[model samples]
Target: KPMTNYQIPQNTLLKFRIFNEFLMANERHVAKEVRDEYVDTMSKIYYSYFKGYSSRLTKLQYEEAAARDDLMGVEDTAKKGFFSSKPHMKNRSTVFTLGNRGEVLTTELEAPVIVPHAAAKNETRYSFECIFRSLHFALMDNCCREFLFISDFFMVSGAGSQNLFEAIMGKTLTLFLKLMEDSVQDCYDSIGIFLSAHIVYRYQSIMTKRNIPALDRYWDTILNHLWPRFEYIVTMNIQSVRECEPNKLGHIDNRPHYITRRFAEFSAAIVGISTTYPNDRVNRVLGQLQAEVENFILKMAAEFPHRKEQLIFLINNYDMMLSVLVERTTDDSKESEMYR
Candidate 1:
């Protein structure tokens, strides 16, 4: 008395096969009116089968895996539903009166589940901490909180926070303005971070498809956008440090100025560390780094002609300052070697 896999009702199977044959043959040659009617009829049949299968599988969620075999029965119906009516999915909401006097009411509401802030905040904090620790171990280890603050600023700005636009000067400015209104710390929601990774992946995929040059081509766009902010920080920190300690005497006097002084100090520290054991390798690396920075500026100027002169001015000032530091370092090294 057991049913066979292929033992569908004979009459129903026959009718379905006939309809299928008609569809395959008439799809291209059928009169418009007949095609429309056939499509409408088939659609209704498809949805009915779809709903029936969905209801049954939902019930089976609590059932044993042995019952999973039944899912195959409606797989075609489900596929039809997905392709045919995906755009028409609607939210369902209802209210019911419970009491005799209608004083008590019950409501049902549905929405896409979103990650809660408490969970999101924890995830953001964890990601920031992990990245911070990694950078610390990588010899770029100074200014823990300062780097965090910059990351936070970028996050809050949101405009250029995504990898694709982060290098753009205009987007960076837009993000800066936006950051003024919100805390960047709060912007690192887990979902936002996850989506950001996906966005970056998609951008890379498109760029690869287009056969674009990766580093050199995009360098200028990023530098032009990032350098103004860098310059702003330098200018701001110089003023702040000077204001904090009018006389730059000792570590004690500088302690109060550390907040703003950290920026310049960090830059100098990196340069010093890179040259501690000087060799051709060190010089070559430094040259490459400087060239990259210059390329970034050139790219920015090329992309934004209106601001080309202004950026060139900033680049010149930056180069001059860096050159002075190198000269001083060379002098001190020679003097120390002579004494030794």
Candidate 2:
């Protein structure tokens, strides 16, 4: 059966719409606090969706599991009920016996459910495969925030967990690289593929430095191979798109924004700026800024003079707060702040 496409919650969708509207609006300024609040809510929504999606395996997963079991010749002994208990050879203790007829009774033992080794192996393989597939789709689906959250959690939980995660990440990257080649052959967005791959690779390289030192060597090799190949593929893809959609090529967004570099950059930039780090002082400052302002750039660009003054006041106050927290003796002049 085809899996039903689970609809994202209506309220979440509404908030997303409003967020995009506010973020992209040219005429009106959205406050920084408003933007941050919306983003927080959006993060929660995406997390909820990711959790739900991971918890329930799709029909494809079930099919794959069954196929794997069949290939492995895995049998469930409990399901077959093919068990017989044997009595002790000596039959040490006998039941009551009569003079004419004697009868010995033995208690029947129940067979415990036994899982075949092959079956257990198949289960483990299926679980890992499903997780990789889910993450792959999640990345492509623009649920990268959720992917980052899950992957980070998995990496730090324990040594065994980290090893399993890195292994699967490697496998997933290899598969994606293969797919990227196929996509290029089919005249798809080769540059986009390279870009996304590099982004993921860079992040994985950074995040796994402490846990998987060997992966750095592997990454060096991959990057060396990727550079020249990426250049060639990107050039070819550009020419192809240019020839195919002459007038609609370059800056023109013929289809959805998904095919454009600007959209990808914008989305990534938002995540980078909005995401909180582990550092206590930085988190506190960023959190405060997010709480106070509704829209940073919009206010700067607003026509109203008072709005500009408000932005200045906010910045000065923020700088003063930061200076006190850091206990730095540096000048807090507007010029210095702007340069910094």
Candidate 3:
């Protein structure tokens, strides 16, 4: 994660360049055999560095994920958003979105038991942020520089250098993407993937500033790759709620329903994440989700036998949902104050 402060290797490529230059300066022969040996040695350097780095990066992600208690808990934490985590650049102008104050909605509003929706409860996760940071460090930051180095060193065309780089180092990129795809395909929590996309998108600005036009397609490809899966997950969630028949359950509880909590938590989580990094497309999705949740609440409220009971139940459930969002308030903002 650009989310975590995990350090990545720096200046390691510079050392490789120094060694290559040193070898070239000291070489005693320029015969075919000598040139072939030199090229072979350089090939090993590129291949070994990238392959080794890729494995380490992937391993680090697994380790961090396992340390988390569970995927559901992770999603719960994310719902509050990461605004307080501090932005990457404090120098950039900052704007804060205020959150509503959670009213005293309960005579005893202890932690509402989160009866999680029917989703996989994975013990560990392959963090999207970790994958994003690691692969990005290797490809855009590390491999980009290394590829340029190979081109200049061997006097190969940029295209040829790309092929050479892929032949040796492409396995790492493939592995990273495959891992991301597999993780997202079977993700227990989507908020992580959702926020991670923003991380990838932000790289566009970095790529522009660095002026590496050739590599822009790589990140774009990544976003395109995960996008469909993300949308599918979001769609499945909305569809589930849309098609749900709350009337079938022949029970009425004055307390908040599990589905209600799921919706509330989901809404709050995305709002929190989006508050820090707002996207129109994501907001549109949130809007749809919010609408479904409201409808669901109305339907759920109708389950109660009495009009007063139905009204009270709706209030309780709405308060339950509102409390989740309100607790995630930012310290400086004018927006929520108007509604608060």
Candidate 4:
């Protein structure tokens, strides 16, 4: 089934219905007396369900799901195994033993370790060549065909190395960092020219649920896809032009000094930082915040004192208001109580 077409299970639907009753009772559209009556009825329902039968029902449901193979995967891997487990001990160690007649014996000796310097050099050369080819494709081939179709708002021009330079200097710094993160001394950088498309695909899937406007979605596509491609092109061009040059006076001056070389240096900056201080947590939080920010702000504005003066009032009277609200809801002296 399409993800959007998937139906919620009947039992889960009932649970949601019960949860929504509490929400409906507190709904602002309803009259205070009627809402108060609902609050009283909900007090009974809440006590009967949550304080009484909910735990038993939950237990039964879990057992049922487990038996029917409907439970979420329960392998230790799913819970805390990876995070909690200690480092694995090395299973094998080199050992020598005396064989019959004092002859030396070994148990499955490991192969000799050797560094293939020439092969490593050749691999590095090949990888650099690939980076150059990728840059060429981005600047010359792809842009030649697509430039007219792509909006000029990205300020992208199909002419000159200045376009390449601007792309690196302007908006591609992040992509350059990412590519540098993937690059290795004697290995090919993973071709991530198409990665932005996948990112946009995932972004669209998320935004569709929030009913994001068409214009915002369009801009999202441009930001995620168009910008990344240009960045890749610029970074690769930097590597191709500056790093490929022969050193002068037999002394190595491999440090990037030119404009493109500076961008290359920027790429190099990501080398150790990305591994030592990975941005996975920050990136995850960013993705979540971007998706939920609108709804979160809307909820806060609707439910709480959000204006400057209102917030000042809340800060000044925080204790008194809290006490009053708590008493109003929980105190039993009133003829009607919000909840029991």
Candidate 5:
């Protein structure tokens, strides 16, 4: 039967919890072998739950098509000692309530809702927000269940449960992060990049608060993808200013030159991107690019036939830059001071 991409985690958790309830109730009476079987069962459930739920994800590597039969091998074991609470659904494949249990894991969705990194082969549709949204939402949505898996059910502390959890989830998780990284390299839109980075930043804070350290590295991996591409775009912009053709510098007119207008827009955007990100290393990267742009502006100014004309070019353009920069900045004052 067709299902949503999200069908896996919740169903997996529900079924696992049925068994968990059984285990917790009878844990003291159960033998060590039984306990190990419970742990093994829960791990396999999670393995199926987090395993590539997205169609595009499987097509690629953490990416390709797996059996995706939703705990296919583990069902018979789940049914081993557990009896059904619900006999009516015996004909249905989902059979919850083993006299009370929990799934095939994930379903093949009728529509592939997730945006593929490049499988769509259309850059516009694969906006950073689209891919990031699908992955991060799915990732964080399961954290509560994950915490439960570790704390309430598994009863393991420190890294025991977390390590195991990451082990099962890490391959797909890392693949998406890597996908986002590669996807970001092709993104030229600052707003999309800014929004995606912002999501990761806030998601990291949320994970930290929830004490889910398993996702910390993944969040960092996402930011790592975002910032470098941002710097690349910034560098590309600065390079435009630096590479202005002297012969094509064109005569200084009564208005700011076309490049000047473009720079003002770029300045507003770059600073806007940097201000929210607030990392020293990234700030420095943009700062150096700004410096290069300033030096080139001077060089461009020198191309003017008259000193007064040079003043016109510099003063008007500088005024435009200052206006946009000042408007974009605030008293809270994030990002590099070097741009000012």
Candidate 6:
């Protein structure tokens, strides 16, 4: 039977509960292949929605132009008035206008002295919002059901504990429900895809850097210590989230976890640290981390013995995931080929 609107909440709630349990209880151990599958699925969804949105926004600009023209007549009223003014009016206007002009004027000036400063600021803040709304609607129409599939999968995979679960689920569901109602699933989907890909890419980068002693030391000291606390201070100032809430959501949350804050700080610190590190020190750290990551991969392969092929696949194709993430985050209009 086709699902009704009323069924959505119930389905989402059930899925959330089920997914949370799976994450918490599943000891089956996911293969690298499985993780890669999620990465690929997420990338595909993100790129599709992103490209579709760019196209829709382009069309929307044209449509908005047409709508504005339809509403505000295009004839240059100011020009018409200036041209139609009587000689006296022109002389008076000229005196005020020609004050800045050369004292000994030729028969004609190449351009208008003041150019009337068109001042046609067609402030379309509301229209832009509507265009965003339209893009969302288009996405939801096509991909909402599929999005629920991924959301459900993540929810059950023990991404957070019950309290954290409720918070994340509540927020995610609220956004989903709003998108469903407003028919803006496309925007939501695009964001979700981008976010998912971003998370994966970050995780991969962190994993890659695990072996580097200096890098790890830098991250541990800067990110794990100073950064998270700094973020906590900012959050306290904003008074955004309850002090008691878990900070797992990072920047997405008003009050993120200390760990989440640490991660952000650490990541931020790396950018600064990279510049300070001597070339030899940087190379040494990178070499160490690469060896460690390779060792870790080998250990994972051994433990999952049967999944060697999948691990190889992931190692070989990881760049694709990063590429998708970069494409999603970049401005689409620059070099249309970036979309591919």
lDDT on C-alpha atoms for all candidate structures: 0.29, 0.33, 0.53, 0.28, 0.54, 0.31
lDDT of 1 at 173: 31
| Model 2 lDDT tens row, 122-229 | 553222222333343353333233233323432224455334334434444454455434433432222222333344354344446434342444445444544445
What candidate 5 gets wrong by more than 4 Å, as runs, is 1-126, 188-191, 249-254, 273-277, 331-340
lDDT of 6: 0.31
lDDT of 6 at 214: 15
Which residue segments of model 2 deviate by more than 4 Å? 1-187, 221-226, 237-340
Give the C-alpha lDDT of model 1. 0.29
lDDT of 4 at 6: 14
| Candidate that scores best on lDDT | 5
Q: Estimate the TM-score of every prediction.
A: 0.22, 0.22, 0.59, 0.19, 0.63, 0.23
Task: Give the clash count for model 1.
Answer: 4
Clashes of each: 4, 8, 3, 0, 17, 14
Residues 139-205, candidate 1: write the lDDT tens digits.
Answer: 1111122122223322323322233222322232333233322321332122222222222233334
For candidate 4, the lDDT comes to 0.28
Each prediction's RMSD over C-alphas, in Å, is 27.7, 33.2, 12.7, 34.3, 18.3, 29.8
> Which residue pairs collide, candidate 1?
167-222, 169-225, 220-299, 220-300
Candidates in descending lDDT order = 5, 3, 2, 6, 1, 4
* Best by the TM-score measure: 5
Give candidate 2's error at residue 135 in angstroms: 4.7
Question: Which sections of candidate 6 miss by over 4 Å?
Answer: 1-32, 63-76, 79-129, 138-148, 154-340
